[model samples]
Target: MFKNSPYTIYGITALILIILLIILFSYLGLNLYIISYLISINLVTFLYYGFDKLIAGFESVRIPELVLHSLALAGGSPAGLLAQKLFRHKTIKTSFQMTYWAIVILQIILILWLSF
Candidate 1:
């Protein structure tokens, strides 16, 4: 099914895994803190997509640009990038697109920085 589009396959599988993880956590009555963290991450991911779309409309404003970076910094970079690519919503010839990817790269560096 995914022979033509590996990205779609990976995205769908990742989404199913997230849902299953949530269900398992809920079923097991896992720690509230962990659940909260998961929820926050999802919220950020959702907002990142929305903000990316907004950038598509306005094509201005550095604040939204920074929020994009911060969302990535907050650990939603991979999902945000996937959404942008899959939706083809923000891929264009503009600083917004350039900055968004730059932020993604920065987020990865920050994550690695904190991890190591």
Candidate 2:
């Protein structure tokens, strides 16, 4: 299913890293609320990608880019990246990718800042 895209490898690697982080945090007795929020948002973001892909096939009204970015900023980026690669949705648009990566970078900064 990965086909010829290197992005598919990167996406899966990111997902694995996220899952490992989650497990480590849980083992360290970190905040359950945060963990739950991450899981929820990721699931929602993944589903949104799938939904958007399905609609796109039919030329239906699409989900707003802002909403997708918002979800990524809210801790769903791993899922977003995975979905983008796996579903091949929203991966070809330069504008969307730029915004999405911006969100991811911002989130990483915020996360590092918060950890300190």
How many backbone collisions does model 1 have?
0
Model 2 lDDT per residue over 1-116, tens place: 65644345434444565566667667777769577558856887888788878888686656767667877887889999999999999999999999999998898888899999
RMSD of each: 12.6, 11.4
Which candidate wins on lDDT?
A: 2
Candidate 1 local lDDT, residue 103 = 76
RMSD of 2: 11.4
**Cα misplacement distance, residue 36 of candidate 1 (Å):** 4.3
TM-score of each: 0.48, 0.70
Clashing pairs in 1: none
lDDT of each: 0.59, 0.78
Q: Which candidate's TM-score is highest? A: 2
Candidate 2, residue 87: lDDT: 97
